[model samples]
Every structure is written in C-alpha cells, then in structure tokens.
Target: MINQLRVKQRDEYYSLEVESGSNLLDVLRRENYFIETPCGGRGVCGKCRVTVNGQTALACQTVIDRDMLVELQNEEKTDILMTGISVQGVLDGTHLYVMAFDIGTTTIVGYLMNGISGELLTQVSSLNPQKAYGADVISRIQYAITTDAEELRKMICGTLLELLNEAAKSVKIKTDEIALVSIVGNTAMHHLLLGIDVKSLITPPYMPKVYEAVELAMQKLFSEHTEGVVRILPNIAGFVGADTVGCLVATRFDHLKKMTLLIDIGTNGEMVLGNWQRRIACSTAAGPAFEGANIQCGMRGQKGAIDHVEVQDGKLVFHVIGGGVAKGFCGSGLLDLVASLLQIGEIDGSGRLMNGKEYRLSDTDVYLTQKDVREVQLAKAAIRAGIELLTKKIGISISKIEKVYLAGAFGNYMNPKSACLIGMIPICLLDRIEGIGNAAGEGAKLCALSKTEYEYSKILASETEFLELASLTEFQDVFVDSLKFTEENDEYL
Candidate 1:
C-alpha cells in the first residue's frame, strides 16, 4: 500500500509518497535530508530523532505505514557568514569570478566573489549529504573502506556542484564563467573529495596517501565548468588536512614572530603551535562529543538545543537555539553546563558527577547524565593533553603562547570562560584566546583572490612539522591525568 508522508521541516511542509514498512531514515536519505546516522542505520546513535504524529521517535527505528505529520527536529535556520577578508591585495587577473568552499564534515559553505575587487557576491550553507553514512570522520572512513569508496566522492562532489550552480546562478553567470574554485577541509573530507584510497588513513600510523596540496582541472569534476584549476589546500599531518593548513594561513601564523596556537575542534580536534621561526601540528581523535554525538540527549547546534547555560542566582538558566522547548544539548551549552556544575561543587575536579546521579537543566526532559559528564571529560582531556604534549615537544611552557586562535564555527560560538574552566584551555591564556570564525573558508577565499596567498600556504606547509599523537607513549598517562576540571590536584578526587 502507498502512504502519504506529510513532513514538517522548519516552517514548510513536504508531502511525499512512500511504500509501506519503509524506514524514515531511508526515506529521508533518499530525499537528501541527511539525518545523522553514526551507527550506519543500525538503530544506534540516537542522533536521528524525529516526531511522528506529535510523538518523538528515532527515525532509524520508525517504520512508516500510515500517513502522518512528521516533524524534523534536526532542521534549523543558520545565519552563516558568506563573506570575509582573504588578502589585502586584489586584481582582475582572470575573466571570470573566483568561487571558494569550506567543506566540513557536518556542514558545507560556499562563497562567490568578484574577480577584481575580491568582494563577495553571494554565499550559502547546507548540511553535508554524507551525514547519512556516519557522523565522525572515522565512521565515514570505515564506510568507505567497507562499502563503495566512490559513493562518498560522488555525494560530496555533488554538494560542491550544487554550491557552484547556486553561486553562479545567483550572479546570473554561466558555470563555465567561474574562473577557479579553492577547497579546504579535514583529511578525510579532502581525500574523499578527490577519490583517493583511505586504507592507510584508517590503518596503523594513520598517514594520508596524498599529503601535499593539489591542483586539479575544474573540468575533471564538472566538465561543464570552465577549464580553471581547483586548488585543494595542503595537509599538515595525518588527520590534520588542508583545513588546518588553511587555518594556519588565515591566522598568518607562519609570518608571525611570536608564539601562536590554532585549535579547530570538531568531530576531530586538530591544532598547530608555532610561529615564523618554527611550526608543529598534531591531530587527536577526540570523538564526536563536542558536536553533540555519543551523549544522551545530545544534538547539533540547532533550534531547541540548549546553546547557552549558566549558574544564575544559584540556579541554572539556559537559552535554547530557537527559544522554544528544550530537546537536547549542543556543544556550547555542554561546556557551560559542565563548568557550572564544577563551580557549584556538584561535579568534582576528577570529572565525576557528584551530589546527584544526573544534573537537570530545567524542569523539562533535558538532563546531563553522569555518563554524559564522562564523555565531556574525555573530550576535554584529549584536547587539553594534546596541547600540553605539543608544548613539551616544542620545549616551551603553555604560558609562553602569545595568541591562541580558535577556528571553526563551534569555537566562534563557544564561551571562552567555560572552556577555560573545564581546562580545555589554559587558565593563563584565557585573555589571549580569540575565535577566528570560519577561517578555513576565509583562507580559501584568500587563495582564490590572490596568487601570492596560495603560494605562501604551500611554502608554510613544507616547513611545518607533523607529530603523530598515536605514536606518543605519554599520551595515555597525560590524558588520564588531564581529566581533572582544575589544575589543583590537592582538591581533585
């Protein structure tokens, strides 16, 4: 029997026909909705939450048989930055405009700018279509190794093509008139976009098959586009792909004379520490805790996900993304909630949820379980310990760092005080921490705007050092020790 599925996404309605017994996730993925499926549709990862007939349920576990109004809990309206400064100089070197992209695992953003003035013409942001396969980089890598590798390449390239078409049409220009496209993302995103083998990436040592920056003909991916070259930024280490390199470029860390550190935390936490004299990079598999994965009642930064929380007048008050009912917790709220719990002496310094079994945000369904507290601890521990290890490798104390550049959208929205309270950032360097919003995208725009910036990144990548975090023996001990919420070991449990 045929069933009429009436889906409510944001403020719009989607009416569609489907066969009986069809899974909601399968139907959604087929329609390009890309609801998160970290377990690959095994009914795990409870990230795919939707509502059927006003009742909340997991999309993967729901079987559609009757016509019902389904509400999408994952949908949101994002005010993205479409334009930013790339380089100081610009010239009309080509006949067509330059298009840039920052391909993230969770979201993809595109920019269309003027060829002469390097001014932004238009921009757009959408969910990455590959989220249907998995959430984190490792899960996506596993999907490629076991399933069809070409599948991922096509899906991602298709998203890029959509961005390109949307951008070109917004300016009333032909696709072939686009002069060049510069792309930047993490290692898995970079490799998958180019259809490279990721076997070595998931194996021991975790080295990428292609580490250097690459330039490909635009016609190779989209034959209809112009014969311009598509530049993929260089990789600094195994998990630290061109996006990290772009972060370095955007911050101008290579030319600065003082000690600088750049940390871009996502499903994978990648950071770089150095200055003009020396540069070193590393990547930690911090898991997807920061992006609202692997925790009970966790979600991406969307409407109803508690984005901000604090202890106000000896009570916890939180602000939701859309200012409606609370559904789950996002990255920023998680950081703030944990830090508040710590300050209130509810959760101990050793990352234990004390004085109660779980922490309640409000009198609603929202809560922070003890296990959720543990997840955040592990995530922060990995990040904090990685910074310490990099500092030791460079023979410098954490206090010597002059500037700490926070890249990615999460970093931009996160509260600096909460990050410092949880020990994810050094207490001494709290004032030095600055959020550089979408630096990867900005870096790509810079490269496309000027040839000088592109060549500068290549030279910087060549001189940088890559330290394998997996190869370090002290990583385990330091991580366990860094789980404390404070530096005071005397008070920690």
Candidate 2:
C-alpha cells in the first residue's frame, strides 16, 4: 500500500507518494529535502522536527502509515564563514578557469576563479548535506562504516556539483569551462568523498588509506562533469587532513621563521605549533561542544540561537543571532556564557554550578546545565592539553609564540578572552592571536591558482610531525588539570 504525503515548507507545498510504513526521514531525504539528523536518524539529536497532520513530531521517529500532511521546518540562512586571507601566488594559467573547495564537516564552500588572472569570479557555500547523517566526523564515519558509504559519497558529490554549477551560473559561464579543481578537507571527509572505507579510520591504528595528494579526472567522481582534473590536497594524518595542510599553505607556515601557532577549533580540534623549523601537529577529539552539539540546550549557529553573551552591569546580556526569543546556545554564545558565569562566581573552577544542577539564562527559557559545563570542560581541556603538550615538546613556553592564527568558524567567532579565561587557549598568547577566516578555503584557492603552492602543500603534509596525544602518559594529567577554569591574567579587559 502507498500513502500520499504532502510536505509544506516556507508556504510552498510539495506533494509525493510514499510506501506504507516508510520512515518519514528516509522518504524526505530520498525526495531531496535537506533534513538535519545529527544522530543519523536515531532520534537522539531531536533535530529532525516536522509537522505531521497538524501535530509537531520528530521526522526521524515518524512512520508514514497513512496519508498525511508533513510540514518541514524552514531552514534558516546560517552565517557561514567564507572570507579568508588571500595569499599571493603566480597563476600558471594551465586552464581557462579553475575552482577550489573546502569540504568542512558542517559547511561546504567553493570558489570559482579566473584561470588566467587568478581572479575570484564567484563563491558559494552550503551546509554539508551529510549532516543529515551526523553532525560530527566520528558519527559520520560510523555511519559510513556500518551503513552505506556510497550514499554519503553521492550526497557530497551531488552537492559539490551543484555548488560548482551555482558558481559558474553566477559568473555567467558553464561549469565545463573550468579546467582544473582543487579540494581540501579533513581525512574522514576526504576518504568518504573518495568512497574509501572509514573502518580503519575509527579503529586502533587510525589512518587513512590514502594520505598522499591525488589527481584524477573530474568525470571519475562525477560522470556529469568531465571537463577537468580534480586535485585533492594531501592529508597529514588521520585527523589532521588536507584542511590543516591547506591552512599551512595559506599562512606559509613552513616558510615562517618566527615561532607561530595555528589552531582550527571545530568538532575536532586540530592545532600546529612552531614554525618552518619544526612544526608539531596534533588533533584533539574536542567533540561537537563547540558546534553546540551534545548539550542539554544546544544548537548550531542559527537564528534564534544565542551566539554571544557578556556581563553588563553585573547582569548577563546575550545577543541572539536573529534577534528574537532565545532558543538555545550556540558554540560562541556557550563559551561566552560559561566565561561570564565563571567571572560572576556562578560556576567554579572545577566546572560546578553554585545554584543548582541547571542555571537558566536571564529572561530566557534556555538553561545551561551541569552536564553542559562538563561537555565544555572536556572540549576545552582537549584543546588546551594539545596546546600545552605541543609547546612543551617543542621546548618553548607559550609566551615564546609570536603569532597565533585561528582558523575555522568557531575559532574565528569565539571570544578570545573567554577562550583564555577557560584555559582553552593560553592567556599569554592572547595578545598575538588573529582570526584568519576560512584559512583552509584560502589554501584551496591558493592551490587551485598556483602550481607552486599546490606542490608546496605536498611538502607540508609530509614534513609536519603528527603527535598522538593518547600515546603520551602526561596527556591525561594535563588534560585533567586544564579542565579547571583558571584566570591566568587580569590584563584581558
């Protein structure tokens, strides 16, 4: 038996027919509706909400047993990080046009450049459709290993092709006019897009099957687009993949003589310390706390989400993203809120709430629970521990660092004061920190436009030392100690 399904979204009605007992989430996905399922449709994330027959319900848990009306929640326009520090490079002009992509776990951004002049013709961005499977890389890897990797591959590839089309269309050109493409992403994203098994990535010896640079015909990945060769940048390690390599290339980290630190805080924290002499890189499993995942009242950096919090006249004043009733806390807002709580003595050094298990925000239904503090602690500790261990291994104090480049959305938007107040970033280096928006994407553009930078990216992947923090015995002690919210200096006013 088949049931009639009507989906109402943004005042537009979409009609379809579905087999009886079919999962609403699956049906919606099959029809190309981008529904968020951070828990892979396991009903754990509570993100896949829809209206069924005039009643609000979880789409992932709903079964289409009868003809019904389904209304999908309208997706808000998220504030995606797109701009980056432009690097100077010589365009080889091998192709008339070229493109670059940064396949971030949360978002995918693409750039269209003039092949001859290296001019940025057009740029596009969209939420990674694979977030329908999971929000974090680990969950996506697990989904790929246990379920269908091909499905994930198709989802990403389809989106990439669409982005390419959108970019070309905006520039009033055909995608086939593009002659070359360069891409960068974390190892899991790299592997998944290439249809490689992710089981090894999650197992004991976590390593990608292919970490070397790859050049292939565009048609090999997408049969529809066969005009160019796609150049995938190399992956440095299991976690520190081509994205980090791209960041290094964008900042010219390998050529810098002054001691510098580069950090990209996201679902997983990837950081590199030192400069051209000896750069040590490590990845911390920071989880998705910074992305507003795994918290009691958490969400992505979307509308109605509290994205910033500050102490005003001894009162907590937070600004929502879209400026309305506060729904929940996003990463940056959560960090600032926690920092404000600590400053006001509501939260102690050990991450304990003074009043109760949950602390409700002033004039809002959103409550920051005790578990949320722990989640933040674990996330921050991992990053701080990596920073400490990396600096120590290089035999340099945090004060010796001359410049700190913070990459990614979270790193760019996060309050440096709050980050340091919670010990997520060393307070001594606060004065030197700079947010280079979307550095990885800039690296991809560099590689796409310059042959010299593309070749240099390979060198960066091979030369950077990968430090397995789990192998170090002192990591646990440092991480535990780093969990405490310590106010290192009173100078950050």
lDDT tens per residue, model 1, 1-493:
9999988877789899999999988898788675778666667777788889999889989999899788885456544544333445445466359988999988999988887777789897777888888888888888899997799999888888888988889889887778788898888999999999988888887888998888999977776665788988888777988888787777787788879988989888998999988999988877788788887888878788898988877778889887889988888888888888887778887778886778776677998889898989889888989899999999999999998888887788899888888888887888999888888888888888777778877887788899887789999998888887776422321
Query: Each model's RMSD to truth, in Å?
Result: 2.9, 1.9
Give the least accurate 10-residue stretch of model 2, judged by summed lDDT.
484-493
The lDDT of each candidate is 0.83, 0.90
Could you give me the TM-score of model 1 versus the true structure?
A: 0.91
In lDDT terms, which candidate is top? Answer: 2
Candidate 2 on 1-493: residue-level lDDT in tens? Answer: 9999998999999888889999999899888898877777788767787889999899999999999999888888888999988788777887878999999999999999997888899899999999988889998999898888999999899999999899989989888988889999999999999998888878876878898999999998778986789999999888999999999999999888889999999889999998878999999999998897778788889999999999988889999998999999899999999999987789987889999999999788999999999999999999999999999999988889899899999988999988988889888887899999899999999999878889999999999999989889999999999988875634443
Cα error, residue 57 of model 1, in Å, equals: 4.6
> Which residues of candidate 2, in runs, are more than 4 Å off?
1-4, 15-17, 53-56, 65-68, 487-493
The model with the greatest TM-score is 2
Where does candidate 1 clash, by residue pair?
A: none
